[model samples]
Target chain A: MKILITLLASIFLFSGFALAETPEQKGLAIAKEDDKRDNGFQDFTANMVMLLKNRQGEESTRHIRNKTLEVEGDGDKSISIFDRPRDVKGTALLNFTHKVGTDDQWLYLPALKRVKRISSANKSGSFMGSEFAYEDVTSQEVEKYSYKWIRDEDYDGEKCFVFERYPVYKNSGYTRQVVWLDQKEYKILKIEFYDRKNASLKTLTQSKFKQYLDKYWYPEEMYMKNHQTGKSTLLTWTNYKFKNGLKDKDFNKNSLKRAR
Target chain B: MPFIKPHRAGWTLLFFLAILALFRFPVKVFAHEISGFAAGEARLFPNEALFPGQNDQSASFALQPEYYHEFESGSSFTFVPFLRVDSGDQERTHFDIRELTYLWLQEDYELRVGVRKVFWGTTEILHLVDIINQNDQVENIDTEDKLGQPMVNVSFYRDWGTIDVFMMPFFRERTFQGTGGRLRFATPIDDDRVQYESSAEEWHTDWAMRYSHTFGDLDIGLSQFIGTNREPTLLNGTDSNGSAIKIPRYEQIKQTSIDASYVVGEWLWKLESLYRTGQGNENYFAWTGGFEYTFTGVFDSAMDFGVVGEWMYDTREERATNAFENDIATGLRLAVNDAASTEALFGWVQDLDTSARFLFLEASRRFGDNWLLTAELRAFIHQPMEDLFFDLRDDEIMQMELAYYF
Candidate 1:
């Protein structure tokens, strides 16, 4: 009779969570689920346009073509080819991101036909005169940060799970980031970045999330605004296609020269 | 593009850039596109000219039009023809086919034919392994410009690395400053009276091979070249007019070189070494090793500061024609990381044996989307009489180039 009663009680317990669950555990679980939804995307390419606005609302534009190759056990490899500002045309940047070690970046100068190995320490600096830092555009791996559950809230009329995460990379410019992810699709909707001094620096809002292959979700636009400088950058992605059969060879340093 | 006056041509190019900047730019990049730059340059010397007819200041104008096309059949063609018109020196005002090449790309290998420029080195202050194209020294004293060489090349990419083989048919001779140029030597090189060690002369076929690999944070390259030397041995001779001139004699030589760089976060270690057998009395080995460390996001600002220090050494002491044979170079690099992409480099090279020093500064900043301003200064100080650069003792040059790209 006692064993029967114990079995009945166990059946009433929660299936996805333990009887005693911490906020950290819930946050980690949410991140893992969010990451799991983005799996199986072998490759992707997109044409991106960036509009940068300053304090007086003066604006400039930049055009870039980018490609990404997903790695099964590690972070993704990416390449960006600059197309605008005519002087920098044919210039390319190749990046290799690792989940737990050093990342590598190489810059190809078209004028000299030379490949230069650049330090990844530029993560804290602005990317192409935009409000977005290099770290902000890098591949988001769950292992790169530690998280804690904050609460559930309605962000812009969408049901979101708010969480706070701290970057594990030593060279990261942000002290912490507050993220809001939609609970249904597990897609990140917003991020608030805090500077090294724990001051609010920038806010990034992602919108127009589109689903591809019935499993992957990508934001069509991302807007980042710096609070201190009153400058903003809006990234609009077009012609985004996934599963393009891009290989590892496409992301090497040598391939950058021919990435036209 | 050629034989145009300096100031008027510069104004015309600026107007062209403005009109092009106003229009909706290019949409046919995949198929083909036309892009290049036009510039107005002024070179001023602080000291008196060394030669009789040389002037303290020179004005020049340059224009380059490049056309690139890639077809769906895995074949591509590139054409870049450059022209410059100068008000002072005739040799400095010339035309060049920078690159006119056809490329056939395949999965494992690619083939290229025609005139092209190829660079191979890892050192910053000095390039020891870069021996493919002949230097266009009249364009700049730093040897950054090159006269393209006619070659047939095939490159193969494998799991280990990449291998490139070349068969160069015609060699280009190096260009030197003329008597009217402010930076000319005591006696200018007579290109018309040039000599060659081989009977085949400039038509001698050259062979070269290179293997380059990147593993983790390390990038390495090994190359071998068997050909006529690029740096000519200036023999004291006379020109066709029987005037005192230096006859440039090209020699057949062989060289093997290795260049490698190991990057560790903000610190990059670089080395370039070479072994050559022909040119001088005996065979020699030369090398340059250095490290560059950068401090990014300096003091919470969007700026980067880089410190560079290198040691250059050569086995042949007095016989070495290179001024940096036994020298140390230190430089500072600064980048604003701003929208304009402003950057500056300050370098100083000191001879170990003598107290001679070479100081130079190069800075550039973009004014708008298409206009760029570049300024450079070079000063030679404390030179000994026996130094190779003693000819540059009284020459201090300041140069400015305003370029418009489209």
Candidate 2:
């Protein structure tokens, strides 16, 4: 019980309850509170559609199904199954995300009945020819980034906290990301990404929030626009179901081959 | 010589019955989907044919239709029927069931029954450990095309690893091109007159078990198979028409294999080795190992280039069954990360002892959303008279295929 008290005392002291808290401390406190609120959902399933558009106004689409299981002390485990474009249908990808180390990923090709291990260095690559990077769509653990509070602002007339977070892991495509979160519930509203040269690269807007189980809030749609490339991707999430009683056994390499 | 055994008809009847039984399962269907592709291909052989009754050009069409159904209890059934029609070779015009399986999946264990295709290997150039399915030689010379095998498989997922046990009751003979095909020997392969070392013949049961696990970045699999050898010994003989021919002789053998792949950063190192016994005094060991280094996002563009190299070695160097006794295979893979998903592979294989080499190029690009265009060029160069592939010296060809998927 003494260790528990020490942990609680640390969290209480660094949570900005005391005076003279630095900007970094307050930013970390906000992130920790946000992460805590989003925890304990157990498991969830959803259907996602990705619409990719190029500079010439051409468009293509992909259909995917997702299942995520929250892990206690590490990152969440997830699986994604492809269902569209005809050729790549029934392909599945399984991922094990970690907080401070390289993540594990595998891809299952239905035609070949083969599963291949993917390198973690490919986290920054485009996710199936879309504008969204692989890391962007994966689970976001609080320890993956370092945060600093910038200011108190209003996002569309609502009270919000604007902060800049630097990626803690190497091989990230971005130098820093400016995040806008609602101060009332700590829900993410928007983000601006800066490239390695410290130039504006992309902006992501998450809207159409809906509260599930009267506690967790999720966005129905997310749009990302790349400024220099004139390309964009719109992700639409539907059929969200939570508390599906998924177990750890459903997130292994064998599950990848059985995802279909 | 004799003709094809009477068991061929029995296998086909069993295949149809399996499909019928799977389709009649009692379950609440949550989803039903259908998708597949239809393709047309044309090939042109530049040089003259090596054997008589052979053609310099060929045209073919292929169709594959897939049916999938998922039940509310987390069980599924899949059916895929395939057919091909070739204008030059009558034997190439054939029909086969690619996949007809009913899968019952639980949290920790799963069961699969019917005709299915399973691949197990790590090396890129060769698939020494992938012995579950019979190669469809009429489809491609690379041995990548497979005919589904009838089996009952059970897999258990546990903390230690995944274990799969298979029971296959029927044996399948590898199909060969007819006399009119360009890539053939001076003596046609008499697939009809097949001989088996076992008295039980096609009724011989095959058993296989595999244990696979992942350790950090290293993934490995160890498998053992006791069954009829897929690679047959071609016994030289004469047909009833007094023509020189080769007869396929199947023998019962036992094999053990290990395949491993370790990924670090942009490098992937792979190895697959196998030891085959019970094949008389011809028991041998062979292995292939290689490394692939990828350069991703080259020059800030969404393009990936990978260099692959593998060295193939065999214990019985000159007397090995196939061509890769002692050889080196190198290739380059290019993936252009675009909306159309364009990709290309160029490779070369050379024998270490003789002046035999094979070079090939394959490229494919998606058109719109449902169509794909593929082109391939294969050439055989500098083959000595004593080389095993000497018959292929005049069999170089250029092929193009267009496929429409739905």
Candidate 3:
């Protein structure tokens, strides 16, 4: 009887230790769930307009065509081709994001008729003089960050799972990012970026959520406000198409010159 | 002859207008539209002309329009015409078919025909492997502008790499500044007295092949060319007026080049090397290697400071035609990632073997949405009499330009 009691007690203790979830585990689980829900979007194309606002309230607009392809077991591949602003017309940027390492990027200059591979060290730098950093424009993979569940909150009249994510890559400009994901659809509603000093720097909010193909949820509008600079950027997306049968050849370096 | 003489300029204007009208008509019928930019440049200096009958100031304007139409068969036709008008230098005024090509894209191969420009190199200060297009020297000395070349190009893309083959049917002569133009040699080049090593002269057929690939953090390109050399050898001759002049002699040559770039963090290492023969029955090698490091968000501002250092070398140091042998070029690039897209660059190239140096500064910024304002200054200092560009030692000039894009 004494031996049996000891064995039962040990089994109970081991099961308790295995089932109890820590904050880190809970955060990772939430992120994995969210990522799993967004799978099966093989490829997509969308048109976007970037509206930049200066400190004095002056505004400028840029039109771009964006295409993204999903890679199994890795980060997505993306390409952005500028169509408006005649000076920058025919310019294209191709990106290949990696799950655990730095992303690769290339920019094609039409005037020079060459493709230049750019360094990814300055991921924190502004992208095309906009509030969005180079890192922000990249597709976020689950392995890019380490997450910790903060608390549940109400955002825009919907229940959200609040989490703080620390970047896993080196030389990232932000110390941490606080994100609010809708509990039902696992859609990102808001994100707050903290600088390297852990000071609040910018806030990005998304609205007009739309479901495409009855499975993927995407926001039609995104706004980023720089609190310290009194500047902002608005990205409005339209003409979203999915599963267009885009092949791997469409996202390579050669495609940059032929993006138009 | 009288009717044509009276309407020469007007006819040119009408011809361009008619081309624009043709391009505009397709925009309404096709899904894609045509676009272009118009720019004007003015240059001034405080010193007298380096040569007699030259001006210390000049003005020029340029118009570049592009049109592309895609067909249902996945083939496309592209047309780009460039026209420049200069009030100071007659040779600088020219027209070019920058690109008039038909491109057919296949699953693993692509073919392009007609006139186009192709660039190949990794160095910032010197482009040793970029030989597909002829240099438009009358426009600028920077070698950034090119006159298009007519060729039939085929490119094969595979998992191994990309292989490109070019069949160039015609050779284009490099344009030179006239006697009345600024930055000219001691004597003008008599174009009429030009000679070619090939019996076919400008009709010589040239061929080239290139293989390029990118793996991980490194990009590499290897190319071979057998054709009329882009760099000409000056042969002393007498003009029709019985005055001594330099005649550009084009020679058939074989060249092999390699270019590579490696990116690590914020630093980029670039190298370009070439080996050429069949010029004056001599063989030589030239190379340029450099590194660029950028510091982002300098001084807590939204600015980037990039420093570049390049070393140029040639087997025939003093006798090199490019004048870049045994030289070092260092430059600074400043970028303010602001709404105006402001950028400034300062560069200095000094000959290691001679007391020759060149300094250049350029800054530009956009105004509103369509206008761009640019300022540039170029100065030469302490040039030896035997230096290639010594004749233009006193041609320090500052220029400003305003460009409107649509």
Candidate 4:
């Protein structure tokens, strides 16, 4: 009887340990692995462009000659130049994003001979009439949201970890977003946006990942689509350079006029 | 249909906006798409007429199409093609192209040339009756009704604010009633008399400039407008008293305005003033100021309230009417979960000159990111007077609108 009792207890203990390893736990582990592959991007810069199509079937293409200076523990500096249409040729946008505070921005208009600061917190607005919102340009800081591990799944034949995250910032555009992370690298594969009503409004897909500096995985292109409007925005990033030692003064309003 | 000669400014505005659109696209790809809406309303409140032509109703529609392309060098281009139709008991429902334009935006400046909308005046809150332009009021009017002049304009942004300047060579729209026109009266002066004559100019140019800035806690702005209104003169010797009078019908007008605002925490205060000059200008000056507060209640709900006042002065040698008006308004806006919100506003406008009053109410709500609705009701009331111009007994109007944005 003693032997039988001991055997039964051992069996129960083993089963308990087996049940503790849930799909969520497995997904989290996979996500950590992917994060390792994608992490350690200290600083980088790129230029981007977008083409917008209106419901009237009219198309407008916007050119952004952009430069970014990022740091691992400090902040990021960004400058954007509008390069098409002779009237707007000298327009420049500059931003100094802090690691723990509000970002400062300045736009330089050649016609106005001045720079304008964007003070309003209306980040949900379309970016220059494009499908992308103003918030889309901001860097995705992991600590800005609360996340929950959902499950481990195979996406596009690659292992992925699905996570639901809620924005903690007051000025965020959406209530919640579900993100898919590559299991091999912490790179974000896709994201689904849910509006205030909890209805899915849009989806973003990232692809064509390239490893730079032997440590950072970068997506060369991204696409976002509005489910209801059938409108779409494609972002193509090119001419990337890393660790340029950008200074805070470079993002000042005075620099806007010379952004080009 | 009688065709009013196209205003030279209108043609220029269309061309400008079209060119802007052209440069935004890839040179090899040129695509054009058309889209707009048509709305018709037949009045049934007072009484319905048996026949459509006899009904006290109006119907209008608009078609706005856009064209675009991409260039081999990765540049962009765009053009907007527009048309309009309006019909009513009055036979003004003729077909016309309301807008056609091109636009181009580059790194430092944006150039918009063509026959397109050239908008000015930077005021966030305007009385429903004060804004003569429908495009400025997003919640009201069809797309074509909100259209503006054909001109070339550009905007430059800096750290403090934005500076926008434009040269409009053509502007085609209805002019305000003055000089004892039939439309100037509140009621029909004669059964068969129309309020306006088709007026068009060959080629004229106007200049406007706007500057907006933020300094510390204050937001400041200034705008200037100088232009000419070229109306067809009465046919060779047609006079106001029934004699034919031929005089230069075209007139020149100018306007200048200054505005400022201050915001601290939940409290916001703003002020604006405008002055006008020139012949046949019917010069008018106006100023307004207001403040508002917002707070969150239990359960993390939000509410806002505010009040404002305004004054206006009319200066015309012929009319010789000086009027001062003050308005007090309060609004309640509420939100839940910071996702959905509803707002209701009430206002009272007091006419110190005539000792009259106008009351108004407006409400708006957002169901989600895609859907929004708004409604407004206004009533003009006062003691009877011998002026015999404005029937201040019981004049009321209501408007409602629904919108979906993508």
Candidate 5:
């Protein structure tokens, strides 16, 4: 009888251990859990702020006054005003981003007296000579890269889903990237970038998640650091709104000339 | 004797076949991009009468044609098939596609490939951009033809700049020879205006590194190159006088250079210095500075004016008898209403010697958004070299061209 009770206890413990998951499956489960946190969001408009820090320990803050108009199925557009650095107070940066095609961009250099088009295909280049590429400021869709479950771990007391993403674009400077999604907020908590040589190059971290819409969660602050170059770009978002009646006609090329 | 080896001839034949295989077959094993395109351009070439003894030019004509194309993203696989001909000279034709090759990018980030162009230069205006050479005339030079290798090369392109190693294995016949064993040949340039020159059993490899950076309002780049050229004759040490000349089958040449430039507002400044060290160690350096200012018609913002001046080294100096020398040249350009449908430009080139001058003028008018008509004229005046006084002629070189771009 004593032997039978001991055997039963052993079987029960073994069954519970079998139910415990591996790191990869745990990561996928956490990702699925996080995806459930965002379901009803369709459109959004927001004013964002950014704080930039250099490797020399010098810090500069930029308060961007802008209106972002994003559609549910279509891409997003932003008309931004540089409010700081008295020199560029009135300068504007306009971006007309598409879902899968090339994005048309223009910067009005008050000095050059002309609106110059940014024809560089390397959108992944450093933004304002910072660690973050221009693509990072834009929204992340589901189709830009292929993902695989990497591992499951606890970051800052919150269980996280870590997945590796490989860029599908031919001109991408990064070969692969690892993303950490929060289990409760579904927001991307961190990202590690691997360059073409499969070497770790940079990392992006998100902090201070704020719930804007009832169903949407957004990071109020973000930071990106280039491990190789020791450079970094920090961003802060403020006053985010969803579903403001912005139409397609407002994003026309002719409108770009009058954005300022 | 029956068992003896087939000797050097057999080895040479095998080597030639191996090189041919490297290009004939698409070694898909080597990763590369393959894209196709269609392009056509109609250029208005100015025409003029040749000197009395020289039959070089007569009437102006336009050559326009649509052609297929194959090109790589980088300095790799490129194949362009096109033909151009002039109306005045029906018998003379120009072939555009001269060199075609595939690339094999290696593991060390070096391009171990076949048929490629090695570029060396950093400024918007390149003084020593001589990796691949071309004719002085713009119309006669084809874009596909490079002063590069028909053989093989390994190149590394980094964010800062590039480094290239190359070898040219080909054979050609010598046509003309002068004193000091100096030789020249009538290069086999096709009607398409593509030119390629190679030495008998000759091989050459070029190695160079370039770095670029930006500081304050300036952009700077620096490069250094060293290489050697091997020839069967150079090693044979045969002199024109039938005496044994001590010449290496190969000779060494090294060039060290620096390019620095600054841009502030509407002004631009650029400088280049090159030091050549070898059998004839000659150091050649050139400097150029330019400034441009634009004024909109406070009344109509579209109207603008541009003025540019450039000074180039002439490379010829009487003091340097043991080495090749050149003279310096200065050019001035003036353009008005450049953004309008109808635009005009006048240019002048002055040789420092004051014995030679070049005058150039051109005009273009755009009809609607699709069609454009252009005409150009050029005149070369050689006061000292002229044996006959055909100072000027009417209708010397007149040509018109019409083009549509989509």
Candidate 6:
């Protein structure tokens, strides 16, 4: 009787384990949870310095002021105004992203005294000649990619969940991207990009995260290295101020011309 | 005139004093800030001018300062003052209000009043729809520079598109190079002799309206203007020396313009066209269409190469003063995605009927912290005497400029 009872108990436990969720289901659940935790910030303004290095190790820096406003049921809106290099000073770029459709972008050229609408198909191109692409700097919506949880591993002395995501938008340069998120805070710590040919293209690492308002987690620095070319860009963010009461009107095309 | 007029030497002194005053102002004056740049340029003509008494070199300096103040309720004020001093040409040495406007922003509408500059059109070769401001001819021959226009503008934003209405109270005449300038005609243009078709002349009330929107990869705009024509027709006249010359005569006209651009991948296709009825029933049409293709990260390097081509046409052909009727323009742009933001562009425009060609090369880069250096070369070939640019055939020259910003 004891032997029969042991056999039945083992069968029941094994069946329960076999009915667990798949990798894709697990990844979708994780992404939803991450998005929920990051909501309700409303708006933010920050200053950033981008350092670019070439194959020869020559370096150049750019200073910019960044502002972002969260939109309900869509991606965030952002504006970046350049303040350095004299020649490009007062140049501004406005981005209006969407969850299911193509994004809208406009560039304000101070010299031309006009605002130019940029092509959304050029999202795969570099941003201001940096290693980061236009899509990389833009706010990534949950609907932008389909995710699949790869595995769990230890990264930087913290437990991390690794996932592979495929972009849903057309004309994207990358075929897939692998991201590492810490289990405790659900914050992204590293990402690897693959080109359209399924070749390794770039790696981005985030560090120096500081909690704001005791509820928001933002990385103070992000570094991106291009694997194809021996070039890299380091973005150091400072003066982060959240919940600035910025409204939808502040992110319109007219504001682009008025941006300092 | 109530405007200040300082002598050549006095202008330099006043410029420095203005800079000093700007620096002395306190930073905490309002909720916004002030910023600007100062630049000096020295131009040299490699060859002798076709006209007599023209100088081979000229020195010029410009100061532009901008100020902004924003209220908590979304109302804002902006002031931009511009001053330029040319040692060789008095007409180029002048000051104007580039922009001094107050803006009130609402949930879906905006209102602006004062002097402002507005630009329109998409094709790089020609800006046919951009007629809000008069040309500042003394600034450059490219037609990209403009004098500010005084007006009241109202804009309404909607999900479908944006509608803009403009009411201009005064008209501004186009500025031309003085007799002493190298690029001037054999006879000088007397500013006071300028003629106007309207009885109100410079004070004629003008109006314009524009509708613009974006649909997916396509952006389009349509606008109409009823006012004094920004482009003046040259009329027979005499200068102070009693020699025959051309006097600019502003005419009343109605113009309707349309501009559109389609972006696909790394390619951009643009078109700009306009129809105008004025100058004694001699109405005509003009259009420009072009495309640009860019190869990013060429040869696995941090560089981009862009090829551009455009065609310009006019119903009146050679009779057009722009001399671009029935012409083709081609250009190459190279960008070295370096930290200094270095770039170079080469363009050539050729008349299909006369084989006349105009070529230009421009390169610029930034250095140190707040300095920018630029160089340019211009040349003309096979220009016919009937063309407007015929007098500039011998003006092939190279130029270098250094600018500083604070």
Best by TM-score: 3
**Per-prediction TM-score, chain A only?**
0.94, 0.92, 0.95, 0.80, 0.77, 0.93
- How does model 5 score by TM-score? 0.42
Clashing pairs in 2: none
Against the reference, the lDDT scores of all candidates come to 0.85, 0.87, 0.86, 0.52, 0.47, 0.84
Question: What is candidate 6's lDDT per residue for B301-395, written digit by digit as tens?
Answer: 65878899999998888777677889999999998877777899999998999969999999988886688888988888888888878888887
Write one digit per residue (lDDT tens) for candidate 5, span A1-260: 99999999999999978776655455445544554455345445556555555567665555566656665554566666665433344367767666565455656553222343443245454444345666666545455555677766898778877788776654566898898876666788899988778999889899998877667778888888878756567887877777666555344322332243
* Clashes by residue pair, model 6: none
Model 2 Cα displacement at B105 (Å)? 2.1
Clashing pairs in 3: none
Model 4 docking grade: incorrect
Candidate 5 per-residue C-alpha lDDT over B378-399 given as tens digits, one digit per residue, 9 for 90 to 100: 5555634331112332122334
- Retained native contacts per candidate, as fractions? 0.56, 0.59, 0.64, 0.00, 0.00, 0.47
Please provide TM-scores, in order, for all candidate models, with all chains considered together.
0.93, 0.93, 0.94, 0.53, 0.42, 0.89
lDDT tens digits, residues A230-260, model 1? Answer: 8889999989899888888888876787787
lDDT of 3 by residue, A192-258 (tens): 9999899999999999999999988999999999998899999999999999998888888777777
Model 6 achieves a DockQ score of 0.51
Top candidate when judged by lDDT against the true structure: 2
Docking class of 2: medium
Please identify which of the two predictions, 2 or 6, would achieve the higher lDDT against the true structure. Answer: 2
Cα RMSDs, all models: 5.7, 4.4, 3.7, 12.6, 20.6, 4.9
Question: Order of all candidates by lDDT, from best down to worst?
Answer: 2, 3, 1, 6, 4, 5
The runs of at least 3 residues in candidate 1 whose Cα sits more than 4 Å from the true structure, single-residue gaps closed, are: A5-17, B1-30, B240-242
DockQ of each: 0.59, 0.58, 0.73, 0.04, 0.02, 0.51
Alpha-carbon error at B241 in model 5, in Å?
23
Q: Top model by DockQ, which number?
A: 3
